[model samples]
Target: MATDKIKLEEIILKAASVGPYGVTDEEIRNSLPENVAPNDRLELYNSLLQRGRLQLKKLHGKLFYQTVEEQIANKLQALTAEERLVYSQIEGAGNKGIWTRDLRNICRLQQTQLTKVLKNLELKKLVKPFKSVKLKNKKLYMLYDLEPSVDVTGGPWYYNQEFDAEFFDILYQQTLRFIRGSSSAVTVEQVASYITSLGISKEKLEHGDFESLLQTMIYDGVVEKLYQRSNNGSSVAVYRSCRHFSPFATLGDVPCGICPVYKSCSIHGVISPSNCVYLQRWEQSLDF
Candidate 1:
């Protein structure tokens, strides 16, 4: 009888070993030999757990069993049918992640159903949701253990889904400091050179990278963009720091500056700035 029990337990472990998510109690029952009592199966589960030959994990209040080596695999067995399908697509997506709409298209699930499955996956800690930096309106889903690609996370321009205005502000100050000490207007290339010289960027700065920052400074009314005549009769664009520029200049604090949903804020959407209470409060704070 003991030998027969060992054989049955081997069959259970074998079934669990095939999938990364291991096997659930129902799976074990289906694989068991005929005439095996439910009590005997439960006893075998307990025996395997006690002897450290198998591990048990509870996800969504259901038990799954697998070997210690396949622990991550066992996590998949915990998902509902829809959740498993969604998770597989996400896992196959690797770091780049799949978009919400794309997920629905691929899975052929309705919007409402997909939303529920995503929420459940999030609750189970199986996946994470991130807003794409380049496509601010797009939400991407990836495995919880994975780090999103720079494009999805907004590269270095953002910090944890929020724009890193402070970082650019520091860069702005640095640019001004470099210009104030110089006698002539600085070309964009020169500015890029100065930024590169500071050893601040993990990767080397390219001319294109500084263009965005330089354009931003011009828009902020702190730096002037000009054209310098070249010896070849062509023109070279240059930047001159505003002589009376105020380092502490700002238009004023708006609610979006401190709002947590600022990352997803849009003019027309579920999380639009027009519908924000914080923005309303800012308007109300001023006396008419």
Candidate 2:
């Protein structure tokens, strides 16, 4: 019997192999074992997106995707560094984020050493884990632990909002959509209002708290800063695809050949899998 990963890879390759395109949820469902639930496959689909193997989008309230390769190369080609700076300080500079274990695992540390950096980070509001649920049984850190670049909510910036992960997810997505439509570079204030217009309640993102997703996006190399004139002057940033900048991935470089998308991609064109049975189909497709 074929493994679930193999089956999903087949589905993704088929969908991505074509162009001017879309692949329906049903088409996705058809590729999986019939006994599996629809939502189960949807979960699988989402995993692929998070792994950078797929690019998920909502159109007229319907979700669809193409390969991350095509999406980065096409939909995000016009993205500029100036626009990327729009959300630079949502968590701002000088702040850091790392997994709980990795923090504990950094070299030159005692094996049993423990500190309340997480707690201190929380108290100063310089960092936060962002989500309510624990992923990998660890807090997913964010930029809220850092000082805010401006009063995100005092007036025009809007900061009195509550926390809702989905809303900020859309805010980050709004930055992406804004980049897609921007004929020229704009400010973070412009990006903020554009995000608010997406029907995400402004009350949830008034403060710098919810902008963590955008921070992670920048750290991940999906977006990059163009420039900064003064500490807070018209600091323009341009956004571009990380593929050209870092196909090897930036933030999530857990070493070895264990990446979720390794079976289907090279992230960078450097070292890769070949003559290995695990990638026979993908290799065949690449004519390797």
After superposition on all CA atoms, how large is the RMSD of candidate 2? Answer: 30.0
lDDT of 2 by residue, 154-271 (tens): 3222323333556546666767767557775545556667666776663545534334445566786676545557567765654433435455345334333455656565545454
Best by lDDT: 1
Tens digits of per-residue lDDT for model 1, 1-288: 989988997888787776665779888888888789988888988887655567676667887887643445456656678887898789778789999999999999999999999999998788999777676788989999888876676665676678888877778789988877789999988888888888776755567668888887777778888898999999999888787765434444665666777788888889986788877877787654
Model 1 worst lDDT window (10 residues): 246-255
Model 2 stretches with alpha carbons more than 4 Å out: 1-169, 206-211, 219-221, 230-275, 279-288
What RMSD does each model have against the real structure? Answer: 16.3, 30.0
Instruction: For each candidate, give its TM-score against the true structure.
Output: 0.43, 0.30
